[model samples]
Target: MYYIGIDLGTSAVKLLLMDEKGTVHKVVSKEYPICFPHPGWSEQSPEDWYAQSIEGIRELTADCEKEMVAGIGCGGQMHGLVALDDQDRVIRPAILWNDGRTAKQTEDLNQRIGKETLSKYTANIAFAGFTAPKLLWMREEEPENFARIEKIMLPKDYLSYCLSGVHCTDYSDASGTLLLDVEHKCWSREMLEICGVSEKQLPKLYESYEVVGTLKPELARGLGLSADVKIVAGAGDNAAAAVGTGTVGDGKCNISLGTSGTIFISSRKFGVDAHNALHSFAHADGHYHLMGCMLSAAACNKWWMEEILKTEDYAGEQAGIHKLGENQVFYLPYLMGERSPHNDPDARACFIGMSMDTGREEMTQAVLEGVAFALRDSLEVAKSLGIHLERTKICGGGAKSALWKRIIANVMNLKVDVIASEEGPGLGGAILAAVGCGEFADVEEAAAKLVRVVDTVEPEPELAAKYEERYAKFRKLYPALKETF
Candidate 1:
């Protein structure tokens, strides 16, 4: 049997086909426009996502026997607000996860409602990118639209509804919505009232591997598949990536350094940081995980290498960055404000401690080191909660860089294991589909068989000592600039 995995990303929808043995048969990607109505606001049409996904799926499985396709799953961008009217038509363009228009609303929730109370109800503090704050912003800014809202959904759940005719979301995705009682794995009534919405307005929640329903007959016909193809409730992007890397079970860690960076740690027992800096969310593997997210990761390098430096050769630029932790120059990777630990949206990126003799390689090294240091900030929070990580499985675009992986290993003082297949969430979704179809016994069993570590980057004692000193200084820079930022 074959399984299909749809990754509904911010810029495009990527479809993947994998057989029972975990061999990738084909992959297809379709792009769509991301609209910026204002300076900091990002939006996309739900219609665009559905159109592109349908077209991409047809292309992905063109050569396969369509009847052999047993199941479909999706791993998608989380926290985007998609509203529907009484007739089930899209009410407005989706407010994206990167959208920052809800700064005021986030502040209001943290202040007026109190962070302690909010965390008690939702196991998370309000953030500008969270769905509940965006809903609150919609209510205040567009009262007419708010009144017309018959249902509210996340980005991928909208696609799930279009395919399965079932309004449902997975636990990992719902954990970020600020409407879920994450510790209890249910909708929080207090949070529902605070957002001025009801439980009926929300989609039914499911575990990531649970089969939501079969694809709609019309959708199945259009895609040249049978109506019996099951659709599994997939996870949020980060959680899905964690599953793909086999970062399941207790004390396992996965670090993703994509456009945004995240440090995800899985735990058998529920745990929340004292500061609520790290997100305490239910994992797709039916356990719990704490995540620390940084808004900018490889993106800072992209900006420097492409926009500022006027070059597209990322590997060439990184070729000369041989010296690890001895560079004098330091950079703060906050290009798009920040999320985990600091949680300050006004924080700006900076290149500090640069000398007149600072070379191009030194500046490049600083960018890499800066991101590692910021990841360490979150690791410190996890440590405060007594979650000690000795090693982590690494994934994402930035994880492709050998130097970056080595730097991360030393800077965090943990072994960084490189997976054999690094397709992240999309591949994970396919694995979930395979499990849902009974090809595997359970998530952990499927992961243990599928996830392979090709190489391990061990932290050198000398390099780790140097990075420890540098990290101490890097941690102070944020506090020093906090008052001004």
Candidate 2:
């Protein structure tokens, strides 16, 4: 049988078709517009997501046997607020995960409500991008829309609901909402009240690999697919990517370098850092994990190359960068403010130590190195909790860079394992679909069989030491500029 994976991303929806053996048959992507009504705000239409996903799925299965598709799973952008009205219509454009308009709301939650109390309820402190803060923002700034909200959905869960006609979400995705009691795998009543939402307003929660419902008969028939195709409650993108890379077992790790960067550490036991710096969320494998998310990663490189440099030849621009850890320039990768560890929405990106001698190459190298350093900051927090890891599976757009991989490996002094597929959430969504259809016993079994490690980037002792010194300097820059931002 075949399985389908839907990756409902911030910019586009990517559909992937795979067989029971985990072989990818075809993949199709459809782009949509992102709206910025004001500075630091990001929004997208849920209608666009649903329409493009339907089109992408149709295109993805065009040459394949649509009847053979047994299951469908979604792995999508986390924490975007997708509100629906009494008639099941979108209340407004979704507040995206990258949106920083909720800084004031986040502050109130962390300070007035108290981090300890919030963490006790949800296993995480509020961030500007978290759904709870967005809820507060809506109540304060858009009272009319907030009053009309009958259902609150995460970005990917909205797609699931559209396809399956079931208002449901998986634990991994729900964890980012700051409405879930992650340790207990349920919605927190305290958080619900705080957000001024009732339990009925939330979607029913499920395990990521569990079947939510079958595809809607209308949707299935329209796409020439079986009506019985199972819709699995898929994961948030990071958790889904972890599943794709086989970062399921205890102590396993996966580092993603997409628009945002994350160091995801899978753990069988539930754990939270003292500062609530790392997110303690339920994993797709029915366990737990800690994740540190930075607002900018490959995005810094993209902005530098495309916007600042006015070129798309990323490879050519990177070719000039030879000195790994010896550059004098330093960059703070906080283009979209920061999350993990700092949790400061006021933070901004900057290049320091630039001199007359510094040219395009040196500045470019700093952007790459800066992202690695920020990831290391999160790794340091994980280490503080005694979750020691010597290696991590790497994925996402930035992982395609061999130079960046070497820099990441050396900067954090850990082996970077390159997986066979860089499909991340899309492949992970398919794997979950396979598991939900009983093609495998569970997520771990499916992951073990489907995911493959093709290469390893090892950190050299000498280079590692050089980055260690440079990282120390990068660490101090953020604190010194905190007031400036």
Candidate 3:
């Protein structure tokens, strides 16, 4: 049997075809436009996502035996607000996870409802990127549209509905909506009342690997697939990425350095940080995981190399950087505000401690180190919660850089394991599909058999000591600038 994984991303929908043995048969990607109607606001059409996904799936399975495709699963961008009308049509463009238009709404929730009370209800404080705040923003600003909402869906759930004709979401994805009682694994009635929405408006939640429904006949026929193709409720992007890296059992860890950076730690037991610095969410593996997210990661390097430096040669620029912790310049990676520990959307990126002698290479190195240092901040929070991590599997576009990987390992003082395949969430989605189709006994067995680590980057004590001092200074820069940011 074969399984399909659909990664509904912010910029594109990527489809992957995998056989029962875990080999990737084919992969296809289709791009779509991301709209910004106002500053700090990001939106995308649900229709565009569906259209691209369908096209991508056709291209992905073009050469294969379509009847062999047993199941389909999705790993999607989380916290996007996608509402449907009475007729099941998209009410408006989806508000993306990166959208920061709900600052006022987020502040209102934290202040009026109180952070303690909010955390008690949902195990998380309000953030500008959370779905509940976005819904609140729409309710207050666009009451007409909010009034017409019949179904509230996340980005990938919308695709799931289009494919399977089932209005459902996975627990991993629902955990981010701020409408879930994450600790209890159910919808929070208090949160629903506060948002002025009812439980009926939400999709039925399922464990990430559970089969939700079969593909719709029309969708199956259009893709040259059978109507019996099962659809599994997949996870949010971070959890899916964790699964892809085999971070399933207790004490396992995975670090993703994509547009956003995340430190994902899996645990058999559920735990929430006292300050809510890390997200306490359901894992794709039917347990629990804690995640700390940084808004900007690889994008910091992109901004410096492309927008400011006016060069597309990222490798060429990075090649000039040799001195790691010796550089005097420091950078703060908060370009798109921040999340996790800080939770400040007003925070801005800064390059501090620059001098006349500061060369281009040093500044470039600073950008890389800045991201690593910021990631370490989250690691510190996890440490405070008594979740000590010795090593972490690294994935994402930024993880491609050997220098960046070394920097991360040394800064965090942990062994950074590089996986053989770094496909992230898309691959994880396929793995979930395989499990749902009974290709494997369970998530643990599937992950243990499929995921392989190609190499490990060990931290040198000397380099770790240097970064330790640097990190001390780096930690202070944020607090010093907090009042101004």
TM-score of each: 0.97, 0.99, 0.98
**Candidate 2 at residue 75, lDDT?**
96
lDDT of each: 0.90, 0.93, 0.92
lDDT of 1 by residue, 337-415 (tens): 8899988887878999988899888988899999999999999998888877899999887999999999999999999
Off by over 4 Å in 1: none
True-structure lDDT of candidate 3: 0.92
- lDDT of candidate model 1 versus the reference: 0.90
Task: Give the per-residue lDDT of model 2 (tens digit) for 189-254.
Answer: 999999899999999999999999998999888999999999999999999999989999799999
Flag clash pairs in model 1: none
How big is the positional error of residue 191 in model 3, measured in Å on the Cα after superposition? Answer: 0.5
Please report the TM-score between candidate 3 and the true structure.
0.98
| TM-score pick, better of 1 and 3 | 3
- Model 3's C-alpha root-mean-square deviation from the true structure amounts to 1.2
TM-score comparison, 1 vs 2, better candidate = 2
Q: Candidate 3 residues 1-485, lDDT tens each?
A: 89888888877888889888788888888999989898787899999999999889888988999889999989999999999999999999999988889999999999999999998998889988999999999999999999999999999999999999999999899999999998889999999999999999999999999999999998787778999999999999999999989999899999998878999999999888888889989999999999999988988998899899999888888888877778899999998789988999888899998999998999999999999999999999999988888999999779999999999999999999999778788889999999998889889999999898999999999989999999999999998999996
